[model samples]
Target: MENARSGNAGKHKTRASIVEVAARLLHEQGTAAVTTRAVAQAAGMQAPTIYRFFEDKDALLDAVAQHVFTTYVAGKRLVEDSDDPVADLRAGWDAHIGFGLANAALFGLLTDPNRGTRSPAAAAGLEILRARVRRIAAIGRLRVTERRAVELIHAAGTGAVLTLLSSPPQDRDLGLADAMYEAVMRQILTDAPALPADGTTAATVAFRAIAPKLPMLTDAERTLLSEWLNRAGDDPASFDASHRRG
Candidate 1:
């Protein structure tokens, strides 16, 4: 029985490996390149085995997309105990941009029509962000209309990061992404009361504003973003121009 169990685990791993490899290839090359026969050859598994895991090319692609997005949200840092909302929020946005810019291909894959299903990963991000927003809303700093803030924040961040990733070296800079994020946060928080006199709570408010829209993540691209967090809001190409990158 133990041997049988081990065999099952091994089979699961092999299937997972195939999914990961196929997702990468599709992201890097495109769906046409990831034929069942090619995946079988690459994974060193038979084509028949691939069929056992996925019904057809479309099924495989859907699974890959779900896996990629799910992985991206699982890695986010949603602060629970922090007193400084603003700084925390900025940190969260920076992390999001870093994740998206570094893994733009995965972002493309997850957002692609062929792969846009909301998996556990995308839902997880929304859940985390929603929780944080609820906390901030409790503070009276966030207005009722501010509920829409989360969507706006994500749109801004995703748009900015996509720009930075696609721009030329002379035009590309992650700092620009940070700036764009900050501008949006300030606009959102402009009407709110000043934070705690000590400033930590106010900072926390700022943090909460940006925390929900953390980054564009997909399981296909797992590398986390560190540099983008530290620099914080340096837009070289300018906020307007960064949005124009193809």
Candidate 2:
């Protein structure tokens, strides 16, 4: 049992060491410098030993991306959530832009179309964004559906990072990310003081946030009401008439 425990600990340490070496190479020399041979040499291990922990270069890159992503997320999670969901969302956007710029190589690897769908780290980040959007909806501030808001924020943040990264540091427009966030927010959120004219939309969004917890409604009733609420989001007049008839 002692020998078995020792072997497992050694394997875990070696795996972490390889990932750390690859991450450093990626940061200093970009993706091309993160080859299996270079990483093995940097980590003081044989090339085949890298394969024992990772199936290929792609797998190693995935591990490096996850490490960077997880580290960034841990730092972000340290900041407590604010009472103002909009402010929280803005903070999240800034953090994402900062992460991408600071870890350009890792960001590029994580955003690669070939690996993004398979990246657990990327999905975890999106889940955090979703939670933020849900909070906005609960506060009756969101104008669009939660899914739409999430997509818009994600796309805007990704586009802002890639745009900034493409330019020389001195030439980059630092305000571009803030502008993008504002543009997306305009489309996804109700204006403060949320006019009575837009009350139906705001009410629908707020109720949709708690639709599942409606104790007076049966499962089937809740599902049916949800469909109508979704439709109401598109055509308030028609939904009002249908509700009157019911």
TM-score of each: 0.66, 0.92
* Model 2 RMSD in angstroms: 1.9
Predict model 1's lDDT versus the native: 0.64
Per-residue lDDT of model 2, residues 1-246, tens digit only? 999999999999999999999999999999999999999999998999999999999889889988888887777768899999889998899889998999888888888888777887788888888988888988888887788889999999999999999999999998999899889989999876245477587778777887887789988898899889887777777888898998
Evaluate model 2: give its lDDT. Answer: 0.87
Model 2: CA > 4 A from native: 193-196, 214-217, 234-238
Give lDDT per model, in order: 0.64, 0.87
- Give the range of the ten consecutive residues with the poorest summed lDDT in model 2: 191-200
| Leading candidate by lDDT | 2
Q: Summarize candidate 1's per-residue lDDT along 1-246 as a digit string, tens digits.
A: 999999999988988998998887876776677799988888887899999889998788777877876676666642454775555566677777777766666677555544554555665766666665555644535432344667777778778877886886577876788688767766565356545453333444444445445576543322222222111223313422433542
